[model samples]
Structures are given as C-alpha cells and as structure tokens.
Target: MKMNLSCCLYLAMAFFSGPATIFALAPENEVTLHPTTWLGENKITAVHLPKGRTRRLYFTLKKKADLMSVTVSPCAVPIEWSLAVRTLKDKPPKKSHWTSKKSMPEVWWKGSGREVKIYTYTGNAVDTYTGPAYAPASIYILRLKSNERDTQVSAYLHEGPGPSGVFPELPPDPRVHTLGVGMTSVTLSWAPSSSVVVEEGQRGNRPYYEYCVLVNPKHNHRSLCAVREGSKKDENEQMRPGKELKKDWWWHQPDTPEDNESSSALWDNFEDPGCVCKDTESVCTVSDLLPDTQYYFDVFVVDKVNGTSVPYTGTFARTHEEARPAVTPLREGQVKWVNLNGDASSQNGERSFRFKPRGWQQNGLLTMHTCNGTGKVKVTVSTKGQELTTQEVGHELAQIWLHGGPSYLIQLQASHSDKSRFCLRMQASSAYHRRAVPVFPAMLQIKSFNRLRTCNSVTIAWMGTEERSLYCVYRRQIPHGSGKHSSTDRCLDPESRPASERVLCKYFQELDPRRAVTTAVISELDPGVLYVFDVYLMRRWGLPIKYHSKTLRTKSEC
Candidate 1:
C-alpha cells in the first residue's frame, strides 16, 4: 500500500526567541564583586614624558579570580613596564621586586612592551595586556617606564564585564505597564534599568545611556521608537564602541568625558534622585491613540560602554479598552505514544509519541510512570530524533524538561533485565491559545547543498541569494521501517509514511548577508539513519524560498 505521510508544520516563530539580548555567559566569564575604579581620582592627560623616573599604577585586586589580562583604553602610546606583588602590609614594588623573569606570552603587535607588564599600542585604543601567571588576591603594582612622559594612559583591571557590564542572562526588568491610559494616548513605563556601567577597574562610570522604546499601536503594522536619536539612521547603525544593539536601539560607545558622568553616585553608593511622579520622559508615551486602542510597548536597555541588554519583557496596553489578548498560550493537546517493537512499552522497546500542541508549548515535560525493576533501566526521550532527555527510569514517575518540536520518541533500554514494561500518563495544563499566522516560503532558494558527517554530527553548508533576510533550517530522520512487529521477530513497515516526518527545525535570523553562503552544524543525531534537510530563506521584503536536500546518511558510530 502506498503510504501518504503528512508533513509536520514547524513554527520557526520569533516569539520563542524571546529577546536577542539574552545571551548565555561562557565558562570563562566571571563577575567582580569588589572592584576598584581605575583612574579613580587622577585626571591624566596625554603629554610627552621626560622619564628617568617612572609613573607606576598600584592596583588592589578584589575578587580572588586570577587575572587573565588587563585591558587598557587610550591605547595610543607605548610604555615599558614590570609587575610586582605585595601584601597589604608591604610597600609598592621598588627596583628590587622587579627581578622576576618573563612568564606570560607577549605579542608586541597588540600592546605588550619588552616586559610582561610593559605595553605599547598606538591612542584611544583597546587592547588586553599580558598578566603574570600568579596575581594573588592582594595588591599588585604595575610599574610603567615610558620614553615620552606624555603618553595617554587609562587602564582597567577587569574581573568580567564588571558590575554594570554585560548581563549573564537576559534582563528581567521592565515588567511592563500601560500607564495613564486615556482616550488620546497612553504611557508605557518599565522598571528603570541602571545606565551606570561598572568596569569596576575602569575610568569613570557613564550615566547617559539611552532607552529605545518601541510602540506598536494595535490595528497598525507600523512600529517606531518614541525617543529617536539624532542620526535618524536605521536602528542598527548607532553604536557606542564595544556596545551592542537590539531590535529597538543601539548605544554608541561612550568615550567623551563630558558625555560620560560619574555614576559613582549610584555605583559606589546609592543616591536616588527624588522621584517626580509627573515624569514621562524616561517612559515612552504614544500619543494620538484611539479610544480603547491597543498597543505593545517594548523597551531595550543600551549601555554606553558594554552594549545592549535584552529588551524588557514586553507589555500590552490599550487606550480605554486597555486590554488586548494577542499573545498565544500553549495548550496541552493529546499525546500518543506507540511502541516500535510491540503494542506495549516493554523493556528494550523503542516507542514514539506524537503531540499536536493546541497553542504555545515550549520548555514543557512529559511525565511517565514506570515500574521499578531490578538493576538500572535507562529511558531516553528524543525530539526530532535528537536526544532531549535520558535518565534511569527507577522511580514511579520520571519527568524531564522537554523542548517541544512536532513529535517526541521515548526509548526504553534495560541494562540487565527485560521482563518489566513501563507506562506513561499526561499531567499537562491548558493555557490560553495564541495562534500566529503561518509564514510561507520565500522566492529565493539556497543552492550548493552539501553535507559532511564528522565524528558524531553532520555539518551542512549552502548558499543563498537573498540579503538582509532570515533563514530557517529543517531536518528529520526518515524512519526506515514501522516500529510494529510482525508475528515473527521482524519489524513491520509503517502504514503510510508519516506525512513528511515530524520536522526538527531550527531558526537563524538576521543573517549578515542573506545572499552569501551559510553553514550550520547539527549534532546529537541518531547515527546511520538517513535524514533530510530543508533550507528556507525569508528576505526583508520578498516572499520566502525553500530548498530540500537529497537523503544524507550520517557515519555510524562503531
């Protein structure tokens, strides 16, 4: 019989991405608890040095985290240097303490001078200076000897992005509100985010960070920020050097002494300006709103030094009819699990479950009840053929954080015994459904489809013609045979192939050049199985284009 498989409709919606500013911190990133401000009181200017004598910077290290390197601003001059360490009781490094040899790597091209602490880089630049192997959690002195006495030197001892540095996760601020909802307008205010950036060991803290507030009046497609900058350029063009931009705004680097103020009033100590209840300048106000007009307010935080943090979680406000229900809620639809080896989920049986999410469903879990057997029985749940969760099913119930796709597969494997079977039940809740309109494929398709199976994963590369667009990748395993078993030990073929296997899709948005070639590495795949890849491209203004790959098999793990 000819099997007709229905394709799974994978929603690569922007809703799930939440915010672009929410970036995960890497292992190397650390937070500084007690950092000392650099150039704290010294306002040194660029001048020529007549230096038989040296100007040494003595720094107190706070956090026990060892020094990776010190980053220097105003990197225009060259300084010969050495490092010395002393306890709180010891004096600064004199001629005697600098006898140690070179221990850290030095690259003269960047900024390092003859010695490890000696750095030479050409003005107002940014470079990381080498540090010794062991910088204890005490006071360390940096001695600088420059030929020209008038070298511009502004330095920072960083532990991380600093107190007001880059956020580890996204921002949780600005839990929004629709304030002063009147017939003609409404005000949107979020929790005030601190503009003061703390490079605890850097120069003065800046206080003049801008807020990018986007207001989308309901029943309209146009969107604009209430406080537009003077450039009148695209949101992406603005920059405060070393800062990042998001959907709403971009903060250029804050370099000027005048534009940057002493956030020390708030950073070193708390100094709250008296609250003015009539203030709407900090908040975004969308005027000319129709009565009961619905609107969405999203505020983004831009730091003059570090960059942009995630936008505040958005809020929906309306004029008069101040409430709108457009955000979709995930509904727990029916979940069906089928044993691949037999009708029952016995030991060593591989089963698959299909779920049709009625609305928004993500970061959810499927609770399964199992009979505790001897030894250890491992149960693994896979979504879109990628292992999502794996654990020993020893308790009466086992649950894991399940990332939603089109379908789910639960496989039961026994280590020693194979007599007992497992059972599963549903314990999901229903939420308001926010159905989003479907997006169609565009007109520009990708070509040069190639796949390479390396180690445990497959890497795919392709080229597209669209620019300034987003691309979505979809892939899924083509199950070889039906999980059902015949009277004999052989597995039966599936009754009509599942219309297009449940797609395992991923999204890559705002690609730098949509017209250029792109590549994505897909890992944790079931080795030796044939899989299909589909690349979809959506341009800023044109329709989307879709391309499919030939059946590609990954190298088996021997």
Candidate 2:
C-alpha cells in the first residue's frame, strides 16, 4: 500500500510542472517603445553602458503568459539572456534572485513575463522586448534606449567675381544689382531663419551663431583664409546676458510664439554685418588695400539647428591712385631723339613740331617734353590725351603723361638705321594724371581701285596712319607696271589731291588711336586700267619709312 501511494504523488507533480512556471513575474516590465530618431541620414546613435549598471525595460501586457521565461532581442547583433523570471501580482511569493548560466559576451539581456534586463552592450544600440503580462492591464511607457551619436562640423565654401579695389552691397535681387566699381568694404546680409522650439518639460537655451570670410588674391580657386570667422573688438565685451534670462532667450523657443533676438551683433563683433543675421543684411568692410589690383572673397553663415548655410558671395573694386604714370600717342611721336650734340640747345626754351591730323580734330594730340640733365624744356602746344605736357618736363627720369584722347602706341624703343636703340621713359604729372582720359584704338582702312578704258576694274584694301607724309598713285598700260611703280608717279599730298588727278580716299590726324577712323576714297576710273597705290609713314623723330599696297582691274559694268 505505501509503495503505491508514493507512485501516485510523483505522477501528480510531473503533470502540474508546466502550468506552474508560466505565471512567474519580475520586478520591472517591458513597455512599447517608439523607433529611434536619427540626427542625419548617415548617423548612428549609441551610448557607453556604465560599469555594473544593468538596463531595465517593460512591455505592455498583450495576451496570456504560457512560457517559463521572457527574452529581449538585440538591435545590431545577437545577444543572450542573463536572467529571466515571471511573477504573479495576486500571489505574494518569496523573494529570490534567479541568475542565468550563459555569461554576457560584450552585451547580454534577459526578459521575464513583461520585463527585460540588458547588460554589457557597448557603442550605439536600440533594443526591443516581446512578451505578455498578467491581467489588470493599463498602457505604460517602454524603456527602448540607445547611446549618443557623434557630431562634427562639415566645412564648405562659396566664390564670385570681385572688383579691383572696393566691393558693392548685396543687392535685394542678387542677379540684378551688382557692383561695377571697387569699394572700400563689402557687406553681407541674410533673410530671417526660424529657430527650433522646446516643449513644456524641456530646458531653455540660447542659439549660438558663427561665420567665416575669405579673400582670394590670385583667384586661384582656393580659399585664402583657412578659417575666416568675424572678430569682435575689445571694446565690445560688456554684452553678455546676466543670471536669469527670459523665455525668448532660451535655446528651444519655437519660431512662431517667442521672439528671439539674434546674436549677430555679438558673433559679428560689433562691426559691419558679415553674414551674422538672417533677418537683416550685413556688410563686410575691408581697408588698407592696394590700387589697380583685383581681389576675390567668400562668405559663410552658421546657425544652431541646421549648422552652416551654403556660402553667399559679393565683390568690390577700389578706385585708382591720385597720380598714375601714363603716356599718350604711345607709338607715333613728334620729337623723337636729339643726340644731346653738346651744342644742341632749345632756341628760347621753346620746342614745337607739327603733323597734320587731316580728318582728325587738332585737339586730340597731346605733347610733353623731358630733358636728360636740364638744358632747356618746354611744350609749344596742347590738345586732348593730356594737358600741361611742357610744365611736366624734368631732368630726373621725367615722364610725359599723354591722353591721346584716342588709341596711340607710344614708341617705347626705337632703332635707327644705324642700329642705335633709344628707350623713351614716361612719368606722371599731378595735373596731367588728374585730367587723363580713356583712349581707344583707331582703325584706318585705305581702299583703292583701278579702271582701264572700257576694260577691267580691280580693288585693293589697306590700312593708313595719321603719320603718312604723302601718297603716290601710279598708272601704266600693264605688261610693264612691274615692280617699278614706286618710281612712276610724283608723291601727292593726300589732303589736297583732287578727284581728277588722284582721288583722296582717307585723311586723318590728331585722332584717338583708341577709336576707329577711315580714310578718304579715290574713285572715277576708266575701264581695263592698271594702277598701283603706295602709302608712306611721315616720321618726325627717327628715320622715315614708307608702307605700300596696290590693286589692278578693268572698269566695272554700268
């Protein structure tokens, strides 16, 4: 009888074992957690698990508890459970610590009923627990957690065209209002940008701003300043906020409700605005710059929430200096070289020369005199390119600033027939420099045509200069004109030639070499005629040389 009774007890214990282990509960429960938010697309969030400190999480009750222990899954990699237990609220059970046999490899976690405990996770992570809890249910917060993300500053740059000296302001419409002249300083301003706001139970903070500016001298496609932020003067240090700040001064104030004052004045250093305020436009003023030089600049703006903005840019130019050295009618000159032949002297400190600028107005030519060691110097006439040409004459590396009021190439180096080279030097006259005008190149086109008695007519084209002494027109019955045309006709004055003898096509003197000027025309020819036209350069300084072009043809029809 005793043996049979013991067998019955053993069988009853085995049948009830599974159901008894199902309702065991733990102290903490796992709750539903939301997905983690990423600061940027390529960022990861994580935190260092403090030594000896284990994590606890709870999930809301779902269905019925049917298992012995619960489990929580790891986010990035595989993990094992360290300790799991299920408890019943209706029954007051004895306090006992239940531990697991598997050790935590870097990270470990275990879930019991509706709760989970994690340990040893490192770097960045996000863990989730899945299980059911006992009845008497109400929704609760889940402890879904992760480590902090690493942050850094991403640098960028912007570039644009600048002026020779100063720059202009940023126009309302960037594309339309541009600076043509160089300015002393540049200004940068931005539109208003919204700030991020904090919720009811959050901390208040102020948004900090930063900026950088760069100037590229060579325009070498590289930022001149490695880090070009604005600066604050020493005198502006008394602007920090005191103990208790207002709600608007806090960092998390939303755009609509609270009005936040900008720190542009502080960050921009109490100077001209250089990309500090998004609401107001700012200007960057630079000084102590060189003249007739070009410079490039770049600007960058920074905010608290989104960080730095795409760089904005503008440029300015500086005006020329007061006295700039220059010369007029650069190439063709009146008085070239006089070999200080010991006895050469200015008759009465007066020197003068005349060249007919036929079609050109006389006021266009300007003259200035310079002496090696001061024998005598004076200019007899005046015109356009420059004024007071004679008064500027001097013995010490003297220069003559000429305007030419037109395009003129001054002779820098002239070699005579004897191969002697003379270099002309130029200097600046305060008066002349002040009166200097912009000169352009003048174009002279000389076209000639030949007509024989009821035969053929051919036309030829060439360029002429205001320095031509005279032109010679030749006509022979072909088959003999050959290369001897230079000796055929007497040189005729290009200005006085009539339409009957030889047509005067173009005539120009005292004209702006910088502009375009054409010569007179020679026409009314017989058919089937052959003619040769030769033009010569009349020089006042060095050896005179002649330039020539020719054409042959039969008269045209009708």
For model 1, residues 1-558, the per-residue Cα lDDT tens digits are 123222221223333554332232212233333222232212222223345556555554445545435544332234555555543323323342122222111111122222233344442223446554343424455555556444444454555333323321223454666777777676777665544322222445334454545554421111111122112333336455666753332222234554334322211221111111211135666665567666666555544334322345667676686333232222354333222222233423443334333335543444443322333446676777698768865423344445556545555544444444533332322222322222332323334334467545677766544234466566556667744221210011111224354233444433334445666776777867776666555433212344544346677764
What are the per-model C-alpha RMSD values against the true structure?
Answer: 36.1, 24.1
Model 1 alpha-carbon drift over 4 Å, by segment = 1-173, 194-207, 217-284, 290-293, 305-310, 321-558
For residues 512-536, write the lDDT of model 2, one tens digit per residue.
3343233434456565555555443
Q: Model 2 residue 103 lDDT?
A: 17
| Candidate 2 ranges beyond 4 A from true positions | 1-180, 183-213, 218-280, 303-310, 313-327, 330-333, 336-558
> Which numbered prediction scores highest in lDDT against the true structure?
1
Q: What is the TM-score of each candidate against the true structure?
A: 0.20, 0.24
Error of 1 at 135 (Å): 14
Quickly count the clashes in candidate 2: 95
Native-to-model Cα distance after best TM-score fit, residue 18 in candidate 2, in Å: 20
